[model samples]
Target: MGTDVQVLYFGILREMYVQAREEHFSLASGATVADLVERIGERHPPFVPIRERIRIAVNEEFAASGHVLSSGDTVALIPPIAGGSDRYCVVTDEPLRIDPLVDAVAGPGQGAVVAFVGTVRDENEGHEVTELRYEAYSAMALRALNSVIDRCEQSARGARVAVSHRIGELQVGDAAVVLAASAPHRAEAFAAARMCIELLKQEVPIWKRETSPDGAEWLGMRP
Candidate 1:
């Protein structure tokens, strides 16, 4: 007997394989995630290079390599999602630029532009943070980011908003996020900017990994 599964890909993997990244596979009964990965590699030799780093998810939940696959399961091969992005509601690996975002939102009628930049600090929770790694479920994260922009613009009258977030390993002093909110007045701009960021944190599916001198751990929240 064979167990069938839906395999999905994200980030770099998705870009590399394009439409072929998602496929329906029939595997031997009781196959493990590792076996699925190997099977994919056999189909696409390029997948072999990053096989070890790809995180597998079963039905939207992160699954271990040894997790047994069941028929009808949805498996996602997640490459570092913050590892890539689509600009505008940007989740990119490129350095964050606030000027572009500021100019983007600023308009002829808008008199105030509230710009916010989030940088990686050298310490967190009394720990000396050496670096930070960011990840996201790219497709969903983009939608979540756009949702925040929509909410801010609607709630704050005359507000125009733009946001950019970076992923991948970043050092201290690097900009993790940059945003601008423009409005006819300072209050509206400020309110929209604040609301956008708060909503992004609450709703987006981005993750952060903090590395200290001793150890490192990942969080479901943005850093």
Candidate 2:
């Protein structure tokens, strides 16, 4: 018998798959995440365009392409998010707060806390940027953020991680993202913090638009 997995779509995927945000998909028993994605791509032509950009999460945690799924599992096709929350992964329109995120990752046993803040810059590629706007596929972004945190935590044993990204209009010098990592040693904390931000930029589905004197341009892959 086939397994009935609950599949969820967010961001562009939600817009493309308008029938429903959540659907029951039938897959062979012991199906891998890649198998389900392949099925979806075949069923929905639009999914084929972003097949590589999309990330998968099973039951709210990031799942690998090879991760196995079972009946009743909830699989989410994450797009990316904004804003801040106490949770390890947050996306919001509100301005990012750094102190709380740093404190959140700090613990009694942790001797080092590393924090990284990414702010809107005045220029990019020689273009004089006036302001920046950020957007995300919230549900997917949150999942991706959590995935980055999970990786950082795993790479830096005993480390705790917290991260936040801000959406909407942001001026130069405004904080766009903040990441914090705490561990028993400075090395681990530093490594975790670096990994968290790098993975976030590379993996998360957050998009940025730059408004310059010339014009406005959206950055990253088009959906």
Q: What TM-score does each of the candidates earn?
A: 0.61, 0.61
- Looking at candidate 2, the ten consecutive residues that score lowest on lDDT are 79-88
Residue-level lDDT tens digits of model 2 in 1-223 = 8888998765435765534567788999899999998898887876776677665768766678999998999887755323222345557665667776776787889999988899999999788999999988876787788778877888977888988788889999999998889999999999998888889889998899999998898986436
Residue 219 error, candidate 1, Å: 3.0
Cα deviation in Å at residue 70, candidate 2? 47
Q: Which regions of candidate 1 deviate over 4 angstroms?
A: 1-87, 220-223
lDDT of each: 0.80, 0.79
Worst 10 residues of 1 by lDDT: 79-88
Q: Give the TM-score of candidate 1.
A: 0.61
Candidate 1 lDDT, tens digit per residue, 70-156?
999988675533322212455767576787677668779999999999999998878899999998886777668877887788987
lDDT of 2: 0.79
- Clashes (candidate 1): 0
Give the best candidate by lDDT. 1
